[model samples]
Target: MIVITAPTGNIGRHLLPLLLESAPAHDEEVRVVVRDPARLPGAVRARVEVITGSHGDAGVVDRAFEGADAVFWLVPPDASLNPKDAYCGFTRPAAKALAAHGVGHVVGVSALGRGTPLADRAGLVTASLAMDDLIADTGVAYRALANPSFFENLLEDADSIREKGVFTDAADADRRAPLVAVADIAAVAAGLLLERSWTGRDSVPVLGPQDLSPNDLARIMTEQLGHPVRYERQAPDELYTTLVGYGLNEAFARGVVDMKRAKDEGLDTGVARTADTASRITFEQWCAQTLKPAVLS
Candidate 1:
């Protein structure tokens, strides 16, 4: 049995099929832990057992993990409090439950630069590292997919990009931060679940093809969209206030601002990656292939 949590999100939605296709011929099963079965996209809901409930719910998660050979787990941040506590608190019980259930392996989602002291003080990257440690102590074989920031985050600024021919952030103009597509992340994660070779590893950092600064993204966007898109450097306070007004909790908003500063300081860069180990997708490719269509529509 292979169980996937947050199965409706960016990674799981693309991963479930890959997992099913890779499984050995036997009494194999793929289960999806979702908040509402009815809300799942038609393709995904049709393929797996939809265990409906929050990933944070002990009973729900407990039921999802039963008799599982492997599980893919990740918790979305709560925009209502200090996100670190919420992340640790949510995963602590689930980790304990997985041990009790005797799960054989777990592939979890996390962020990059986890243990670096230079990581943003308010960033959830630190908290995710803490969760990775707790999960490992459960004695279950674990692989944390340490991913860089997503190229998909640009979608959040779609409206502004369309309206003002620009998107804004606090990142420095010259620093190129690694940005991976969710498709590649899901592909690698699904591959990890079925392979037996990488079981005991600490964490797998999925560094995408190349790093891009705000200016780089803007140029890619402008070229791909056939428009004069530009990058605007917003003040940290303005960024936080804007995010808060958009309903993000103040702490989460501030954390993001701090992270942008960290990115500017080059804290978001990771060690060099070999092409064979991870699939690499560039920012221009991501924009031309993914973002342009969404923006034009």
Candidate 2:
């Protein structure tokens, strides 16, 4: 059996269909740990065994990982907690469960900048890397998909772009860095789970086809969406204050601010985009396919 966590989420929602489509041929049964079974489509729930609860819960992972060959792990963001508690604390229980269950191979969704100087200070990214360490310590054959900021993140700015022809971020206007589509991340995760041929622990960098800066993104959005788009660089302090004002934990707000600062300082530029590392989705393509619709709608 193969287990998947957060099956109704962005990455999991895409990963499930790919696994479900191929698992039958491989003689693999798919199981999912989810809080709300109803969030899964009727057809999806029928195809997999559902363990209902937060995967962060020891009891839920204990049940889900039992008799499972490989597992896809994803931690849903909880802004109520600090960075370490949000990522590492959430995975601690599951890490123990993996060892106890003796699951062979595991694929986890994680961030980039593991070996870079900025990694230790990148706040949330630092916490994510630490979580990867915790999982690897369990001695399961683990592959942490180290990914950069996703194109899907732009969806959060769609309304602002549509209304004012502008979007905001903490990065400098001309500082280029890799970005990826969540679909590509999901596809990579599915492939690893199905193959299960690799051993030991290592991170796979899912850098997209090319690097892009805020200005590049604005230019692409203008051409694809048929509107004049502009980039707005927000101060890190302002971003932090806004997040905290929205009732997020103070430490969590600082984590976001620190992450933004690191990315601006080239935290994500450590990885070179080669064929093996670069994923298929380009930002321009994603803008046309995903962003345009979201903005126009």
- Which candidate should be chosen as best, given TM-score against the real structure? 2
TM-score of each: 0.93, 0.99
Per-residue CA lDDT of model 1 for 1-297, tens digit only, reads 889998778887778777767764545688888887886768767768878888788898889888888889888888786767668888877887899899988898987776566654737776777788888889888888888788889998888888889887787776787778898889888877777466564778787887778898888888888889998888888988888999988888777777666666666675566674346677888888878877878
In terms of lDDT, the best-performing candidate is 2
lDDT of 2 by residue, 74-128 (tens): 9997999999999999999999999999999999999999988999999899999
lDDT of 2: 0.94
List all candidate RMSDs to the true structure. Answer: 1.9, 0.8
Query: For all candidates, what are the clash counts?
Result: 0, 0
Model 1 / residue 228 / CA error / Å: 0.9
Error of 2 at 221 (Å): 0.3
Off by over 4 Å in 2: none
